[model samples]
Structures are given as structure tokens and as C-alpha cells.
Target: MTTLSIYQVSKPHRAILQTSDIASILKLLTDAGVPFEQWPIRPLPQNADAAAVLSAYQSEIDRLKAAHGYTTVDVARVTPEHPERVALRQKFIEEHTHPDDEVRFFVEGSGAFYIHLGDQVVRLLCQAGDLISVPAGTKHWFDMGPAPHFTAIRLFVSPEGWVGHFTGNLLPGLVPKLDSAHA
Candidate 1:
């Protein structure tokens, strides 16, 4: 299930709002200038390659590209067996901002995106079929958990793909991780 939790940046222990309702999540995120939606899931082989994954969602990818001026699209898959899971998690767990919108569609598994806005932080737990677009320059961090396992389709306006500008804020470390936030 998908969950959304809002917390004060200074007080990470308690959430101001928490719910698993999709409608509420969409409304809240939309009000916050974040694009949150769901797309129908497509069946794919267990070990589908990037090309295969892209082919499965070609229509949607084309639509997003046309709508958002996205110039690049790719698939990212990470599993617990990945040798660099620890380093990859550390890299994304810190607060960072992108030059362009950070868009992603979850095709398998789940991950949590912590979006920092004003005094509140929104923890969005995204599962399969969920698509989230974080506007450019938004301070946020992603928690793929200790043993990450997910397959996501990422879109970028720039062909350079993901380039993070770290905020150097320790707030991400203070907040609850994916498991705790989901609970």
C-alpha cells in the first residue's frame, strides 16, 4: 500500500499527517506542487532489461516526454543482491536537489521519498504503479531502505540524467526511514 506522512522538519518523531488513502495522498501532494499519480502496471519478465522495460511502457513514456519536455528516459533496478546497495543507499539518503524535475514511476517494489517544503517534510511511500514528479530545486531525499529492491522508470529533462546538488542538511538522517515511516 502507498502511504503519505507529513512531519515538522525540526520534530521528526511525530507526523502531523499520516494516511494510506490514495485520494488524500494525491490531494496533499498536488497542493504542495508535487505531481503524484498512478499508472496501470504492465507485466514483464522477471529479469527484464532496460530496453524491455521501456518497451512495455513506451506509450506512457512518450506521453510524459511530450508533456514535460523530458529528453531522457531510463530504467533503474536495484535489489538486495546488488553489490553496491549500501553505497547507493547512502548516496540517495542525503538531502539533495536536482536541476530539473525528478520524475519516477515505480514498476516494482517500493521506496520512500522525503520532500522538504517550508517547515514540513512530506514522506511519500511509493509502491508499484505510483508515479511522482518532484519539481526542480526541491530539497528531498530518497530512502530505499537497508536492503533496497525496486525497479523504477526515471525521466529527466536533461540528457545527463540524475545530477544531485547536495543540501548538506542532516535532517534526512534525523527522520524515520522507509520501514518506520511506512509503519
Candidate 2:
């Protein structure tokens, strides 16, 4: 299940709003000019290969590419047990923004995306069925936590690839973490 929780920049305990309803989440995100959605997730058998996952979502991929003018799509997976997970975390833990929109659809596992909007932060917990598109220049950071593990499909408009422009602001730690409660 995907969860959307909005909070004051202060902390998760200071949540301004929280919900698991897809419609409410969509409406709230739409009203805020952020793109959020839930796609019908195809349940793959355990150990299903990446090709199978991609094939299952091909039409949806085409639809999104046509809708958003995205030029390419790729799958990414990260696990806390990966040898370089720590380094990867260090690379992306800080607040950053992209030159183009950061769009992702999770296929498995979960992660937290904290988006800074005005004085508030939206701590979006994305699971297997979730899709979130953070607009270009929106301040945000991601966390897979100490035990990170997730598989996601990424859509890109620029062939140059995903690039992060670090803001040098470290406010994510000040916010609430994604935990059982959020899940």
C-alpha cells in the first residue's frame, strides 16, 4: 500500500495530513500541483526477472511516455545489503532537485520521498503500486533507510540521465522517518 503524509518542516509528529486512500492522495497532490498516482500492480511470482516486470507494465509505460513526453525508461533497484548501499545513501541523502521532473513507479519494496513545498514537507511513502512525479526544481530528498530495498521504474525526459543538484540543506533528518506507522 502507498501512503501520503504531509507535515510541517519540523517533524513527522507534526503531520498536517496523512492518508492511504488513493483518491484522496491524488486529489491532494493534484491540488498542490504535484503528480501522484497508483497504478494496478501486477503480482509477479517470486524471482520473476526484470524483463517480466517491464513487459507487464509496457502499456502503462507507453501511456506515461506519451502523456509526459518522457524519452526513456529504466529500472533501478537498491538494497541495504548491497555492498555499496552506504555510499549510495551518502550520495543522495541530502536535499536536491533535478533539472527535469523526477518520476518513479515502484515495483517492489518501499522508500520515502520528502518534498519541500513552501514551509511544509510532504513525506511520501511509496510502495509497489505508487507513482510519484516531483516537478523540476522542487526541493526533495529520498530515503530507503538503514535497510534500504526497493525496485522502481524511472522515466526520464533527458537522455543525459538523472542528475541531482544538491541544495546543501540537510533538513530531512529534522523530519519524520518512514516506519511501520507510516506504512
lDDT tens digits, residues 1-183, model 1? 999999897787778789999989999999999998899999999989999999999999999999999999999999999999999999999999999999999999999999999999999999999999999999999999988989999999998999999989999877888756333
C-alpha local distance difference test of each model: 0.93, 0.83
Q: For each candidate, what TM-score against the reference?
A: 0.97, 0.90
- Model 1 accuracy (lDDT, Cα): 0.93
Show where candidate 1 strays beyond 4 Å.
Answer: 181-183
Clashes of each: 0, 0
Cα TM-score of candidate 2: 0.90
Q: What local lDDT does model 1 show for residue 167?
A: 88
What TM-score does model 1 achieve against the real structure?
A: 0.97
Q: List the RMSD of every prediction in angstroms.
A: 1.2, 2.1
lDDT of 2 by residue, 78-113 (tens): 876889887777676689999989999999999988
